[model samples]
Target: MLDIYEFSAVFPSGTEIYSQNVQHTIRSNRRTLGGSLFFDKLLAQLHVKSVSESRPPSANRGYLYPPSKDGNLEELHDKIVSAEIADHYKQSLLYYLLKDCTALDDEEAAETFAKKSHLSHKYWIVIQGLWNLDHLQFEAALEYLTHPSLLPAFPEDILRVLIDHGKLANKHLPLAYYNAVRPPLTNPDLQKSYVTYLAHLSLIQAYFFIETQPVQDHKSLFELLIDDALQHSRSDGSSNVVDELINLPLTAEQEAWFEEYLLEGKGRTYHAARDTVVARRLALGKYAEAIEAGQQLSGRRFNDINWDGIKDMVATSLGSRVEVDSVFNVAEI
Candidate 1:
């Protein structure tokens, strides 16, 4: 039977010396189970004592098990004696241990430990944090994303990180994330916001790719836009045709057709067609043209179209909305 009193007495200096001695003993007698148990128990006691000294006075004030209570100390002592500190302090300690355990570099070891730790909720947090954008450990990210405990948090940050790092093109990343997290992402508002953000990013990417990339045929670009719109429509319950039209990329021919076939027609309805034309113009880096076209369209619908803003954004690359005007003239007119 381990004496808890004796263990508590060796705090300030005995702890370090005990650790060194334990390490030496473990090396010398690798096969001694009794020795291993004794060393682990002593080390656990030392750890509990250290934590006790450093803990804030306010901590555990309202908890059922207050740190300084005799009963809590006895519980710690019992855990140490049983060589089961791993079970008792697993969640709190594992979080610290896994902080630098790289998902890519230390994946196997980390995953093995995660399985053995028997603390799935805390383990999920560790895995998700490691897979975030700052880490960009794709292999690790995918591995953790597959974990049953880490589904929703996995897609949200990981996809955004990939997009920000340019590892995934704008069109694919959002859809991928949306798909990955959909089963778990139950909030309609969050779903709508994420889809809208993705749509915006896809439109920005399409504009840049079309203007600078010397596209031989418009098929891929059109497909990307249509797909993005479709995804948004699916996620948000919006009409697919409206979304497609609003996201279309207009060429000179399409612009001319809009003027003759749509805008000049007797029953001209400017809102939907104009929104699509403006969106296309914005996507083409044709700011002045966008502004002019936007102004010709009727209703307060074009009011939301920022023509001066778009004009200032002409020379900039896609997604760079640096332009600001006193007000959107199209909206006023």
Candidate 2:
């Protein structure tokens, strides 16, 4: 057994090398095992050390039993002592000790090893949480991974897994997990995936969540959120989500971002995206700008209904539906 000092020298903390090694080792465990491969592998390593090393025959064996003199003993020896398995064993010893202690039915030896290893318990919890994910136990994974005590780590990787592989009944596991953990993702790809998921799940929630993000990221996430909403909306203007998005009480900065995204950014592909922006302007009581935008739009959802008629219709709808103090006073229009 390697001492804690030797282990620390081999795997320095807070390095990319250590993080990748832990991730690789956890992902290597076979998902088919009902119980932990950690315990079984540890037992095999102890058995190999007992037989191969020059230990005295009278040494305390603890829970290990002497193998019967049979062909099975040789086969087990050959399998556990292989170079590939031994290297993996070295990488996984710390991870295994952590898992064993956190298991529902704990092992005292594993706890003892964990104490001796002197690894951070938070790091151990994170690895165990990810191990649960590798096995497709999402609920159990979330319970530990999303706990308030744990600071976010490996956030983008975890988000990718949940978004790509979660098979919950509602298909909202990614959104749920993100809401609970709120990991600050720096990768553009993962940020796009996460916000796209959130937009499709709940436009209002996505809007509010975007409000809390960094101002630099707000425009991109908002643009993606609006593009996703527009893409999924029916051309005939039937999506309640579209209505919710258009009617959102946006801040002045958000309103400018929304207009720029639809009028000049990636939201231009959809036929009704511009018209949706005009409707939003109308909802925000920018009647003059709404009419100007309507005239500039090359494609309109209602080509036959003139801008004046559309304005009257929108004003009527807002008068009946919107609260006087919440949005704008209809009388002002």
Report the number of clashing residue pairs per model.
1, 0
- Model 1, position 141: C-alpha lDDT score: 50
- Give the number of the best model, judged by lDDT: 2
Residue 263 of model 2: what lDDT? 87
Task: Assess each prediction's global lDDT (C-alpha) against the native.
Answer: 0.42, 0.58
lDDT of 1 at 175: 47
lDDT of 2 by residue, 1-333 (tens): 435324333323321221333333433442333222333434554444424242333322211122222232333334343435444343344454335324424434345554555546765566567667655677677777887789875666667777766634247778767878877877878778877777777888888877777788888888878877877676445467788788887888888888887888877767777778778877777865765576555423433444445655655755632332223222221
Consecutive 10-residue window with the lowest summed lDDT within model 1: 9-18
**TM-score, predicted candidate 1 vs. hidden true structure:** 0.31
- How many clashes show up in model 2? 0
Question: What is the C-alpha lDDT profile of model 1 across 1-333, one tens digit per residue?
Answer: 212234343111221221334234333332222222222233444454313333432322322121234444344444344454554244433322233233214434334445544545644553454423233344445444545455354344344444444234334544454455553333433333443455555555444443432244333434344445544544565654444455455677545654444345421443355556665666666666665566544434332444444445553543434332322343443
